[model samples]
Target: MTRRPEQFSLNLRPGNLRSRDPDARAARDFAARDFMDGGGAPALETGRTRLLVAGMVFALAFIVIGWRLVDIAAFSPGGEPRIAATPPAPAFESGRADIVDRNGVVLATSLPTASLYANPRQVRDPAGAAARLVRALPDLSRTEIRAKLSTDRGFIWLKRNLTPREQYRVNRLGIPGLYFEREERRFYPHGRLTAHSIGFTDVDNKGLAGVERSFDAVLRGRAEPLTLSLDLRVQHVLARELAAAMTEFAAIGAAGLVMDAATGEVLAMVSLPDFDPNRPGTAAPEARFNRASLGLYEMGSVFKIFTVAMALDEGVVTLDDGYDASKPIRIARFTINDFHAKNRWLSVPEIFMYSSNIGAARMAMDTGTAVQQAFLGRLGLTRPADIELAEVGRPMVPSPWREINTVTIAYGHGLAVSPVQMASAVVAVVNGGEFRPATLIKHAEGERPAGTRIMSRDTSLKMRRLLRLVVRRGTGRQADAEGYRVGGKTGTADKLIGGRYARDARIASFAAAFPINDPRYVIFVMVDEPKGIARTHGYATGGWVAAPIVRRVVERIGPILGVEPVRDGAHEDGGEELLVRAKARASKVATN
Candidate 1:
C-alpha cells in the first residue's frame, strides 16, 4: 500500500521513525541518535524544558503574591488589615487634657474628626477629583488641590479636621483614592468669651498662646482636666460689661481683670477685640494681643495709689501731711498738672482722692526714688506679673533713676506696667499687706498659697480708707456700687505714640475693690484710645469710661459670689470720719 501523508505525520512521534523520503530518513537518523543518547529529540526536549521552567516561574510568582497578601493582612505594622476605603478607628479621648472653669464649665477640649486624605497614584482623574473635592470644601483652592493630586505621591493630605457634615459630603462624592483618617481637634466652646485666657491650639493641637501655651506640657502629660481659677459666671459678667463699655465709648480696645483678694485667684480676665479661639487664624494680630497681661501703659492717677501707699509706709508722709499743688510744676520742659486740678495745698488723702498729679509728684519726691523703686519691686510691679499665662508684660521703668523720673512716675508717667501687674499690686496693698503671685490654677479644697508681706497691715488698712474716699466722693464716684462699698481710683494717661504723648489717644482705666471696710475682690478695667461720647459729656477719662464698668461688674457679681450687701452704717470703720474730713478739705480747696 502507498504511504499516506497522515501515516508520515503519525510516524513523526518519538521511537516511530521509519521513513522512505530523504528528509524523513534524516529525521529518523536524528531520532535514532537521540534515543541512543538516552534522551528525546533535541528540539522537543529543549521546548519541554522551557515549558516546565515557565510553569515553575508562574507557580512561584503566584505563591509569592499569596504570601504577601497574607502577610499584609495578618502581620501589618498597625496590627489591623487596612482596607482601601475604611481606616482604623480613632481613640475616643484626645491625648491633651481638658480645660475647665472653676465651676467645671468646659472652656477647651478635643473632639474627634475625620481628616480627608488621598492616594494620588490610585486617583484615576486628578482634575475631576479635585473639582469634586472643592464642592465639599469650598475653602480649599481647586488649583492647589489639583496640583497635589496630579503628583505621583502614594499618599497626600487633602484637608484636616473636617466637620461631620463636611466629611459626610466628601464621602457622598464617592471619588476613588479618597480616604479619611480619624483625628482629634481642639475645640473651644466659649468662643471669644475666654479667648485671651484659654487661648487656642494649632492644627496639630500644639498650644500657641495664653494659658494654653503656658501649660502645654502639663496638659499633654496629665489625664485629669486642668481646673482654672476662672469663674465662668464672673467671666461672663466682666466680659459683657467690658464689651458694652467698649462699644459705648467707641474705644479701640479694652482689658479687665477680677481677682480674689485673699488668694490671688483670677476670677475673670478679659481682653477685648478678642478672637474666637476656634478660629484664631482669622483674627487680626491686634485682637490676639493679651492687653490684660501683655499691654504696658502709664496708668495715670492709678499710680497715685502706689505713690501714696509708698509715702505712708515709709513715714515720708502721713494722711495729715500736705503738699503744694496750686500751680503746675515745670521741670526740664515737662509740666505736671492734675486732670481734675484742685489748685491749692492739699493733704495726702486729698491728693489721692482728687488724683492730683502735682501733689503726687511732690509726695513721691519726699519718698525719694530709691525707696519708691524698692517698694514697687516688693509689690511685683517692676517685673513681669507671675501668672499662668505666657503673655506677661515686663514693666517699663525709668532707667536713669533721676528725680524727674520719680516725679513723673508718681503720677503714672515715665513708667509703664501691665493691667495684671497693677491688679496684683493693688491686691497686696488691700489684702492686709500680703503679696501673693497671681495664678490661674484653682486652689485645692479652698487652700491658698502663702503670701509674702509687702506692706504693713496698718498701711493696707489706710490705703483701703483712701480708696473708699475716692469712690465715695471724688473722681471714682461712678464706680461706687450701692451697699457694696466699692472703693477705687480713676486713671487717664496720654498714650505715648512715637515718642510723643497723644492727647486724644488715652488709656482710661479704673481700679477698684469692694466692701472697703473688709476687702474681698479687686477689679481693674482699662479702655484704650476711647473717644468721648455725648453721654460721657465729651470726656474719655477713666471716671467717664471705665469706672461705670467696675460698678456694673461689682453689682452683678456681688450677689453671685454670695457677698452680703451692706446696708448704710452696717459695716463702718473708725476712719470714715477721717476720709470725710479729707473730702471736705479737697472740696474747700476746689471751690477756692
Candidate 2:
C-alpha cells in the first residue's frame, strides 16, 4: 500500500498547515537536504579540512619545542649543562693563592675571567658569526676565527681570556654555538717590572719560570698569600734606575739584585729586555732570560773581590801585603794588564781600589788554585746559585785546574759566573763572612736558616774598609750616594762572542752595599753589551754605566727602608784613613 500511495503524504492541503510546527519542519528539511545527491561531498570535505588544520597546528608547536630544547641543551653559549643521562664537564683551576710582596702588596693574583669557545659543528653561519665575533674582539683576526668556526670539531677555543665588559659585549651579539668557560687567569699587577723574578704561568695555570715554578705546589695547596721577600718600593726603585741606565747606555739587557746581607733574602731582582709576564709566550727568548741568575759571564774585575777574599780567608795575604804591578803578566801569549796601571808595588787596599788586574792575579796565585776553588765552592760560587729558580746558571770554572786558569780567573777572565753568585759572594765578604743561601721567601723572626761562616771577622772587617775606600776614592767613585755610605766595586769585561772578545761589546757591572758602617743590603747591577753614550764620554765601563744606577737606587730606597742618615758625624771613625795609609804605603815603596 505504501508503494501505491507514496504521494499520499504530498497531500498539500496547504503549506501553512505544515508551518504550524516550524521546529519539526526545520529538522525534516535538514534530513532531506543531507540525503540529496552530491550534497554530502561538501560536508565531508569541510570536516577533513578542519581536522588537517588542527593537526598541523599541534605538529608545529612540537617542532618548535624540540628545536628550543636542542638549542638549550647542547648549543647554549652559557656553557654545557647536564640533563638526564648526560654527564658534566671537568673543572679547571678557577683560583690560585695570591703572590704578594713582604708587605702584602699584590704581585701576582688571579682574576675571574671569561674565555670564548665554540662548537664548530653547531655553527650554522660560521663566516657571519666569526665576523661579528671579531668586531667584539678587535684584536682577533677575522680569517683565523672563520677557520676555527668552519671546522667540524665539536669544540674550539676562540680566545683564552676576555674582560668582563668585553664578555658582555660579545654576549649581546646572540650568535649560536659560542660558549664561555669560567676560569682564573694569572695576573701580574706590576707587569714587566716583576716579570723575571715572579715569572708567569701557562694557559692552564701551570708555573713555567722563576718563583712561580719553584713554589707551584705550595701555591696550589695554600689559601693564604705567598709572601715573598721582595719589597715593591725597592723593586720599583731598582727597576726604574736600571731601565734609565739601560736607555742612557743603549744596553741590550740589564740585571740587578738587592739582597738582605744577614738573612740572604732577596729584596729586589730585575732582568731586562724583560717582557710582561701576562703574555710570556709572545716574548722573545732574549727577553725571557733571567740575567740576574741565569746568564753566565766572565765578570771581569768583579772577580777580584773573590780573589782578595780567598787570599784573606786562607791567610795567604794580609791587608798590609803588597803586590808588584810594574807590568802586564804574560802567560801562554795571554797578557793581563790593569786598565789604569800604577806600574809599582801596591798594597791590598790599593789593589782593590785601583781594580788592578796584575795584583788580583798575584793574589789568586798566592791563595793557590786548590784553596781558591774550595773557598768559592764554600761561598756557593762553584755551582748554581742557591736561589729558588729553575734558570740558575752553573758556574763555568775551568776543569783540570791549572796555573794559567788560576791567573786568568783571578782577573775575572777564563771562568764565567752568574751575577747572583757574584752578589752572594759579596754578601759573604761583607756581611761578617756569613754565607747564607739566597732565598725568595720571607722568613719569620728568628726563623732564618743557619748560615756557614766563609771568612773570619777580621777579613770581613778589612773587606768593608776596602770596599768603602774604593767607592770613596777609586774606580767606584760614581757609585757614592750621599749619607747612605754606598760601598762597591766597578767591573768591566769584554763580551766573548765566537770564542773571541768583541771589541765594542762589554758587560758593565757594580756590586755594592750601603751604610758600610752597618750593612743591611747588597746590590749588584750588570749591563750587558752596553754601548758608550755621548754623555758617558765614550766609555761603557762599569764605573761610567753601572755605578750610577747603584747610586740612584740607594738614594731612592734609603728613606723607604728606614735607613736614617748620620748627618752629624761624630768624626771618630777613621776607617777611611786606611785608604790614605794604603796610598802612603805606595808612596813609601816609590820613595824606596
lDDT of 1 by residue, 467-508 (tens): 988987789999988669888899999999999999899999
Clash count, one per candidate: 0, 0
Estimate, for each residue in 1-592, the C-alpha lDDT of model 2 and write its tens digit: 3322332254234553465566545545654664565478778889999999998999999999999999887888975445555566865444578899999999999888999999999899989998899999999999999999999899899997899999998999999899999888899989898898899988878899988898889888877899999998999999899899888888899999999988999999998889989989899999999999999999988878888888987888878777889988898788888897988888898899999999999888878888887887898888899999898998887898899999988878888988888888889889999899888899996676788999898888778888888888889999988778888899999988999999799999999987887788999999998998788889999999999999999999999998987585645243457666667777788788
> TM-score per candidate, in order?
0.78, 0.78
After superposition, which runs of candidate 2 have C-alpha atoms over 4 Å from their true positions?
1-95, 117-136, 140-158, 171-178, 568-576
By summed lDDT, the worst window of 10 consecutive residues in model 2 runs over 2-11
Candidates' lDDT values, in order? 0.89, 0.86
| C-alpha RMSD (angstroms) for model 1 | 11.1
Model 1: which residue pairs collide?
none
> Per-prediction RMSD in angstroms?
11.1, 14.4
Instruction: State residue 502's C-alpha deviation in candidate 1, in Å.
Output: 1.7
For candidate 1, what is the total of clashing residue pairs? 0
Which whole-number lDDT from 0 to 100 does residue 279 have in model 1?
A: 91
